[model samples]
Target: MTIDALRHSPEQLRARIAAELERARNRSTGLTDAVDGDDLVRQHSPLMSPLVWDYAHIGSQEELWLVRDVGGREPVRPDIDNIYDAFQTKRADRPSLPMLNPDEARVYVSTVRDKALDVLEHTPLEGRRLVEAGFAFGMIVQHEQQHVETMLATHQLRQGPAVLDAPAPPPGAPAAETEVYVPGGMFLMGTDLDPWALDNERPAHAVGVEPYWIDTDPVTNAQYAQFIADGGYADRRWWTPEGWAHRSNAELTAPQFWHDDGTRTRFGHVEPIPPDEPVQHVCWYEADAYARWAGKRLPTEAEWEMAARYDPESGRSLRYPWGDEDPTDEHANLGGRYLQPAPVGAFPKGTSPLGVRGLVGDVWEWTSSDFTPYPGFAMFPYPEYSEVFFGPDYKILRGGSWAADPAAVRATFRNWDYPIRRQIFSGFRCARDV
Candidate 1:
């Protein structure tokens, strides 16, 4: 199904969101303790925000933008005016928001959730919808999925080993693999008409490029360490000017969580990478450096999507590579139930038709495309979203991390971040000309 079909009517969407919220409120452990406060906030990942604030942040936002404002109710709590806003903010530690004790934060979250639910119950589902609920629900789902990711990253960052889950396919179930070739050609690039994208995904214009080959698997920790041992981090020739400057400033010569023994990190109080696992926490700059050191380059967004959407009969214009179906574990490594990036070759059934595994999940893939707008693009009444990042800094990334909800992993989900930042969920794959 196309993204356009997922749009739900106002009443139906609200009912679904309310039901989903009930499930979440029932299922989640729900911050009963705060020992992991620092861990809960994804302070180290520029690609993520602190978990303590995510739901309330966006839930509160939907109220202001979608419900309250739409219904003509002035905000009841002006103190919250800027507290939950994300579009105007930068890093969480930059003091953009006041830190709330767990209690105040809980109260704030409850109020927002309840208010949205109340609106759903009271507002007539019928009249011309003020905003598209499906799109709004998509934003909520995306926002929550990002938090679960931040939480997983926080768990790994603070707790060391990831929480385990049902075993994925045996190693090499899909073979250790070889470079898969994508016969590229003219393709529609972005959802210029997709109303839900962030500012960086705007101006979804057509981009022409030649066909190329991309690795069937994402770059693993063992592979990245080889770059470091080869002085990939130390060499100026391997890095772009911005990347070099960033490395110089951060004094980062290895992955953020890399340790001397080189295998494990001390999350919360544990250890680091297993030789076979896919790497986590590397930034876009690091991915680029590794690609350069390996004598290759990161995939352009178009090439990445083209491979992921392989189907000679269906065409790459389809929303996701695995047909247009909303994702399930059968399709990707999403949802935190696994709680970690699986070993490469673990999901044979999940591979793109081109035989690329983990295209929809595992780690968010850094793309060579710049975050730009589609032709004749306009933000979906959420003014700050696509208009804010029209600047030159942000770069596009695709796929979702292991922490995201599988249902949220559409081929069209667009994410963007500055290249210099490093966090656990952002890593990349290599592409070269056939």
Candidate 2:
């Protein structure tokens, strides 16, 4: 089913929601089931919560929004609410908390799903802000899918043999051009019409971007390797003061999981780094440095959005790079269809009107922008989701990763992380002013 299927008739929308919920749950369970109970409870990395926390946390949120708030039903398991509250507890401290055991977490989430499904059946699809067009349900589905992606990242960090498996992504024809030119003009930056879009992506506003050139496809591993080969890490000239400081302190010679033998570990398997594939696990600092080394700069958030969504011919922003239609396998490498990013230019059909490719998926692209709210931004449902993170402390990443779920990702969707963080599946393309 399409991600925008939520806008259909009540009957079709119900079925679509149910299918998406099931799809997300299957992913959550599949990842958790691959390892033993011990693995689920143990924190794989301080950067991520235990897999079990995510499991129950998914259900806790579903129950809070769907069962209690939407349905006006009694809580399924109020005792564990604090345990899974992300804001109340941080990732590093979660493993120490009284979180539910693996078996208990499974049972709790299952129980909550049953109640949430019942609420879905009875809840009206109109009137209220949250329920209108089943926004609440869509939000829950996206929430669960987001956690599922997080679990996938945790799996990548866990020690041992590869427990996950997926076919490699399709190869791509070499791009005829390295960079696509975007004309300077005004285009709607965000979305006010998209019902399921998070609050941060709402209230679409006009943004005037300067004409610039963006890489047609994400920067490849070979390109980044060249940066490293040229003493990019040792040279401070290519890096910002902050980036150089972090690089020195961390002794980051290459992207995370990369080894000296010209190979990288992916999902516990060591393989030669594919020169054609987009580089992943690099932080904002690394991407920025690489851009500087190449005599380019990371695209600003507005520039990135313009490249991904603005249709100069139509003078309107499309929902995705390809068009307003929801993403399909042919559109991008999304929904964990492949465990790793496709080769750059693999999804030609996903290319934007301006000939930019790989904007929807593969790896989250770091943009040279702070994680700030749009003009006239307002928090919805809660403040912790977006409002609290607004500032220069976090750098924004555009485009979704291969690990991202389609329902949770869009051209306007904004993801932010600390500049020093390298755990996320992130890559970047260079841009230069015309």
Expressed as tens digits, the lDDT of each residue in 317-338 for candidate 1 is 6556666556666666776655
Candidate 2 Cα RMSD (Å): 1.1
Relative to the true structure, candidate 1 reaches a TM of: 0.84
lDDT of each: 0.65, 0.92
Model 1 per-residue lDDT at 270: 36
State the local distance difference test value for candidate 1. Answer: 0.65
Worst window of 10 by summed lDDT in candidate 2? 1-10
The collision pairs in model 2 are none
Off by over 4 Å in 1: 1-14, 22-55, 71-74, 87-99, 122-130, 154-176, 192-207, 266-269
lDDT of 2 by residue, 265-356 (tens): 98999999999999999999999999999999999999999999988888999999888888888999999988999998898899999999
Candidate 1 at residue 357, lDDT? 75
Error of 1 at 409 (Å): 2.9
Who wins the TM-score comparison?
2
